[model samples]
Each structure stands twice: as C-alpha cells, then as structure tokens.
Target: MEMAPMTKRDKILLYVVLMLSFIVLYIRFLLIPGIENVQQAKADLTEAQDAQTAMQETILMASVNAADKNTTWGDLQNANAVYYSLLSSDELDTLVTGLELNHNMDPVSLSIGEAGTQNLTGYAAGDNAGQTAAPAGSTAAATDADTDAVTADTVGTTAAGNAILQQILAADLIPQYDQASYFRTSDVTFSCSGDDSDFFALLDDLADNYPSVQLQNFSISTRSYAAADGASVTGNVYNVTLRVVLCDKGGVQP
Candidate 1:
C-alpha cells in the first residue's frame, strides 16, 4: 500500500491511544492484585478477632466452673463432718461435764461402757411396725414389760444423741468413727444428788434438752445415816442413779 506523510494531529491521537493502553495494563497487573491482597488481609484480621473473642469466652466459662466445683466440694465436706463420731473418750467426758454444768447438776459417778455390742433386739428402730406377730407363748404382762423397756430405751437413746450434738457444736475439732456392719451403742451410767425441784426439773426436760438420749433407768431416794445411841440423824441425803444409751451413728468396736 502507498502511504501518505504523517500529520502532527494523527501522531498526537496515536500517542494518546498508546498511553491509555499502557495505563489499562498497569491497572490490571499491579493495582488490581494489590487491592485483592488488601481485601484478603482485612478478612483474615476479622477472622482472627473472632477467634480471640471465642477463646476469651471459653476461659471465663472454665473459671466459673472451677469456682462452682470448689463451692460444691466445700459443702460436701461440711456435710460429711456433721455425721462424724465423737473425737475421743476425753472429749466425750468434757461433753458430759458441760451438760451437767448447764443444769447445775453434780453427778457422783459417770461410766461409759463399750460399743459394738451387736445386741440389737427390740430396740431396732422402725422395725416394730413391720414385725410379725409374737409366738403363741407370748403373755400380756411380758408384752407390757417389753413395751415399758422399749420406751425407756428410746428415751435414753434420744438424750444421748442430743448430748453428742451439743458437744460437737461446742468443740472445734472432730474425729471420725469407723463404720461397721452392725449397729453399736454406748451405755452410760451416772448418779446425781439434788433437791426435788432441781431433780424434777431435770426429769421433765431430760429428754427435751437433747433429742438423742434418755434415762434408761433412774432412782431417787433418801439415804439414812448411821444412828448413834442418842444422836439425832436429821440430814436427809438425796441419791439418784441414771443410765443412758448412746446410739452410734458411726459404729465402733471398743
């Protein structure tokens, strides 16, 4: 083809077109990729922020659960402590002394017997209701006597339990008693001398003061002093004998 000489306007138009094409190539290659990278970075940052928030929440929940567990464990320990047995014989004696002191009572002698007798007979709690009828040879008087004895034993047991509770409340330290297959109890005997008013007051509230113990048997009588040939034996001595049973929540052998 025969070509004409180029004009300044034509060259200017060609230069403008070339510049536009170069600009388009730069935008597609460098600017577009950089913008895409910025968007990706923003998305990654948002994801990381979300992950951090979730982890913080998990840690807080774990702390709360640990606190709750500790509180529950403490409560469980306290409940278990309440069910423990007396610390020792000395502690038991101190408790007895406290009870007597509370009522201004002075006992002549106090004796605590052994446990683990395994001699649960009619005294087994909650058994009478479901018990089978007695054999043919059972007599009415014997039944009456049995009922009386059972009543006395129940009273004694109630008193003992109450006294033990009072002692535990007063004493800070506690010791656990060993658990056994069979039931065990302590037989306590004491003697006191008091006037009619004090003795009667004790008798009235003996079972009421403490719910877990009672007097198995008791006697109050006046003692007679030796009479010389002409001496006046005037002073009336007050004597009282009491027996109580202590049912063990924790069974012990000795």
Candidate 2:
C-alpha cells in the first residue's frame, strides 16, 4: 500500500499528545512529590508548635509556685529524719540528764511512754527524797492514817484508768494517723528538784528552747532540804513534776 502524505493537522495532533504525556510525567515524578513534601513539612511544624506551647505553660506554672517551692526548701531544715527518734526512751533520758547536769539539779524522776502506758513514780536516790520523819503525836498519827487510806483508794482508781487508756492507745484504729506527715505525739513524765532560782531557770530552758516539747500538766511543791555538801546547812527546795506531750510535726522519718 502507498504511504499517505504527512499532514500539518496530524503533526499538531501528535505534538499535543506528546505534550500531554510530558505533563503527566512531571506531575507523577516531581510535582506530586513536592506537594507531599510540603504537606509533611506542615505536619512537622504543627507538632513542633504544640510542643513549644506545652513547655511554655509548664514554665509559667512553675514560676507561679516559686515562693511555695522556696518555703518547702526552708522547711526541710526543721523536718525530722528519725522515725519517732525524739519519743524513744533513750533520747528522753539523754535530754533530761543533760538538762539536769547543766543546771545542777537533782532529777527526782523521769519517764518516757507512748500515749497511754502507766508510769511508775520515780524518787530521788536519797531516803529524804521519798519521805521525811513523821511527827510524834497521837493526833498526827491519826491524821496520817486517814490520809494513807485516801491515797490508797486514789492509787487504785488511777491504776484502773491507766489500764484502760493503754488499751485504747495501743490499737491501730486509723492507719493514716501514724504516717510521717502527721505529728507523732507521746507522753513524758518528768520530775526534778531545785531551788526557786534553779526552777525558774529550768522553766526558761524548757519553755523557750526545747523544740517539739509541749507541757501538758505540771505541779510544783516546796520543801526545805539540807545541802548535799553541807550537812547542817539547809536550802529552799522545789519539787517539780510535769507531764508533757512531745510532737514531731516535721514529717521526719527514720
């Protein structure tokens, strides 16, 4: 078959088809990939912006709480580290002995106990610390007998109450009350003998200086006693006994 003459219309039509193929190739290989890259970059930028915003908010919140943060740092100094260290028997004895020796006072008695255990009355070493000579008269003897009877009854009642209190205090009714954040409150029975001046000094030390020690109850009695060094010389004496509650409010733990 003889080939037909090539026509301009056919040439233009072939050129248009070639151009269309090139456009499709460009979109598939380059333009479409560029568009996808742009979309990916937008997503990454959004993520970065969200992270920056969150960090800024955290910084602002921390700045607002700066004063409380500083206060918490300062309170760390007063916090107790030992779990119930101040309530221990040895610690109480050490505190008492140190105070007594420093003031040159005779410790009549000292006891460390938890909330409700019965404490025995402690007396000083000398016989005179516990008792003095009785008056030699029938009337005095009769009066003494009556007083003794009353004392016996009072002691019996006290014993019964102490037993009940101990039972109540020993139970773990509320577990949270024993946590370090709460105060560890305990009882201390203390006694010491001194002159008026010495007694005042003792009070000043305990009242002004002793930390975490609170006086719950105290009684002071006066008497005359011969000085230990001087047999003939006598001095004014005051017997001081007190019950105190000790607390560690510092969240101290062992």
Candidate 3:
C-alpha cells in the first residue's frame, strides 16, 4: 500500500519545532559566548588601566623623593664645609684675635699648643681639663694650683654631673674621635676679662660657627676694678679662662 501525504497542520508543527531548535542553538553556542567574551575583554582592559595608573604613581613618587634627598645632601655638605674647615696655627690665632676684638674682651691671651694625637682616655680622665701643654719644645704649662682651682670651680660634686660623665663614657667616644685621619688636634687656652654677656656671646659664636671645638674646662671669677680717678667701678668684671680642644679638618701637623 502507498503512504499518504501530510496535511497543512502537521507541516506547520514540524516547521515550528525546527525554528525552536535553531533559537536554542544560537543562544547556547553563539549569543551567550559572545556576551561572555565582551565581559572578559572589559575586565582585562580595566585591569591594564589600573596597572598603568599604579606605575605612573610610583614613578612620580620616586622622582619626588630623589629630589628631596639630593637637596638634603647638598645642604649637609655646605654645612660641613663651613663648620669643619681646617685651620692652621696662624688662622687659629687670627680667629682668636677676631673674637677678642669683636667681644671687646680686654686682656685676652691665647696659647695654642702643637698638634698631637688626641688622648681619649686621658681627656676623659680630666688630664687636660684646665691646661694646655706648651707648644713643641716648650716645657711650660699651667700651674697645678690653677688647674685644681678651675676643676673645683667648674666641675662640682653632683649626682647629675656623674651621670653625664657616665653617659659620655658610654657614647663610644674613641671611635668617633678616630673616625677621620685628617683630624689635627690641638689644645687652646685663652683668658679674657669682660661682662657676663660677653662670655655667653663668645660661646654662642663658637658653637654656631665652629662645630669641631670642644670645651674641656672653664673658670669664671669676679675681679674688682679701680678707676684712674681713685674711685671704685660700679659694674663687676668677670675673668674667664677656658681650655678647649680644637679639631681641624686639614692642616699641617705642626
């Protein structure tokens, strides 16, 4: 027997099923994957932009820090040059003379000893506290009585003083003392008579202008004066003796 042909209703049902299958395949294989690919591209682009921004920020910060470091280093060099510049015997004398004249300190006397290797232990022991050894080939020195008097006047017996001395000892002074080979050590003793203000002003000048000078010992006493007309002066006069250690950066050993 022969098969019969399909009617219009069956044909329309078969066509509708095929169209539905096509729609499903397009959504699964083409449209959904395309949508996912677009999302992934967007994520990668965002990540790259973030990384670029971070790199730019890093570069900018590094440049700024370099500039700051260079400026700081330059400033330090300038300060060192001013404070640590070497001085010869003549230069030291000139500096002392200038200080005397600038402060109007009368009866100023300065004695500069020859350069020598600094004795760290002896210095800390108060061996060179109030006196400077005479220049080479000279046996002269401050009297032992004067040294004792200065020590008694300046370095009193106090707990605080002892603690400070201990701290100085613990500060690794030897290495710091020997760090530079160019250091030329000298002991300078100077005495002056002036008002109290003059003494402090002179100290401030030394501190601000000369960083390598260390005050070892000092003594201050009141001195009475009589005018030429046989009348007593109204104000007090201070006689000050100071022993200082001067370290020059570059100078002749003598």
Candidate 4:
C-alpha cells in the first residue's frame, strides 16, 4: 500500500493536540498529587498548633487553681493569729496612743515587726530571778515576789498587743506596713523603772501598745531626778532604747 502525504496544517494540529494532552496528564497525575500533599501538610500543622494551644491553656488553668488552693482565707486568718500572739495588748495600745500624740511622727509609717533582728535581751534577761535586782542608783530592789508578779502580768500580753496592732494597721495609721513592700528598720525609746514592783506590768502595757513594732535591740540605763520640792528622787528610773525592723509578707523593703 502506498503511504499518503501529510498536510502541514494537519501535522500542526496533531502536535498541538498531543501537547495539550501531555500537559493535562502532568497536571492530573503529578502536580495534583504534590498540591494535595501540601494541603494535607498545612492541615496537619494547623491541627498541631491548635492542640499545643489547648495544652498550654490547660496548664495555665491548673496553675491558677493550685494558687487558689494554697492561699485560703483560713490560712490568712491563722497567720494573723500567730503574728498577734507575739505581743501584748497594752503595749500595742500605748504605742498607738503615743504615735497619735506625736505630731512629728507619721502614724501611717508604722511597719510590721522584723524577724531575727528583734531583741528582748534586757527584758528577757530581767525576767530571770538573779537578774531582777534594780540597777545601781535604783531606790528599791526587785524582790522575787515582784519578779513573779511581773511575769504573771506579762502572760498573754503578746496576743492582746497583736490584736490592737492589727486594728491600728487596718486603720492605716502606718500605711506603709500594710503594703506588700519589703522590710525596714526603726528605732524606739521608752521608759521603765525597777523600783515599781509592778514594773513588769508597765512592760506589759508597753508590749500591748506596740505589737506591730519589734523591739529589735534595746539597752537599759538608769536615771536620777529631783522632786518638785528639790528633794532627791528616791526611785530607780529606767531608760530603754530599742531597734526594730518592720517586715511585710513579700520581704524587707529595698
């Protein structure tokens, strides 16, 4: 059989058809698969991100719950009680009253008692039997009975003092102490006497008055004076110097 000659137009048309077919095959078989793979990968990435976010949220919620459980109102109340038990009522009252009377002092500047730095050296030492003797130049000796009486009077004074201290604090007399700020030191001075058998009662009063103020450090010294008639004063006078630090829950102030 003799072969027929092809027309140029027909050959061009045939080539165009073949090219189009190949392009369509490429898109359907190869490119489409790759595109689908990319879409799947993107979907997977989105799902992973969403899951991670959910997990993080869960962890955050758990942390919040834990914190809520840790600091209950009961716990706060207990802490308050424990803190108040360290001082006497009369002492705290006196401190508040004195601060009220002192125009130069800012009552709101009062602070919580400092730890470790607080000192009851002279007071505690004086409570001992041999230590009860009035200092030199004191008019009367501190007898054992007087010492016992003083000790008895001081009992429970710390708690009462703390209660008053809290009231004063709530009143914001010393706004600084109520803040969550750190701790700071303050100096306090007061008077005492060895001659009075009820001298411990006076100490109790002082403790009750300033429960929030810690007696960080203290010194006891004697003083002498004359009566209005110019007669020599017959009693022992005590002067006390105290160093105290005020602290907050967060720590000491910088």
Q: List runs of model 2 lying over 4 Å from the truth.
A: 1-52, 59-71, 75-87, 115-180, 221-254
Model 3 agreement with the true structure over 168-235: per-residue lDDT tens digits: 22343323434233334666777666677887887766544443355666777665556446676555
- Rank list by TM-score: 2, 4, 3, 1
Segments in model 3 whose C-alpha atoms lie over 4 Å from true places: 1-80, 84-86, 119-180, 223-254
Residue-wise C-alpha lDDT for candidate 2, range 181-210, written one tens digit per residue: 233445666666666677678767665444
Give the winner by lDDT.
3
The TM-score obtained by model 3 is 0.37
Instruction: Put down candidate 1 lDDT per residue, 1-254, tens digits, no spaces.
Output: 87987899999999999999999998999899999999999999999999999999989899897886576445333322322243355644665556655566655567776544342222223223222212122112122221111122232232223223323322331233322222244556665544567666765555444332335566665664443354434333334333333334344221
- The local lDDT score (0 to 100) that residue 107 gets in candidate 3 is 45
Residue 183 Cα positional deviation in candidate 2, in Å, after optimal superposition: 3.0
Whole-model lDDT for model 1 versus the true structure?
A: 0.46
Total clashing pairs for each candidate: 13, 2, 0, 31
TM-score of each: 0.36, 0.39, 0.37, 0.38
**Range of the 10 consecutive residues with the lowest summed lDDT in candidate 4:** 143-152
Q: What is the lDDT of residue 107 in candidate 1?
A: 52
**Cα lDDT tens digits for candidate 4, 148-205:** 1112123322333223333433443334443223223345555443444344444454
Give the distance in Å from residue 198's predicted Cα in candidate 1 to where it truly belongs: 1.8
RMSD of each: 17.0, 18.3, 18.1, 13.8
Name the best candidate (by TM-score): 2
| lDDT of every predicted structure (CA atoms) | 0.46, 0.48, 0.51, 0.43
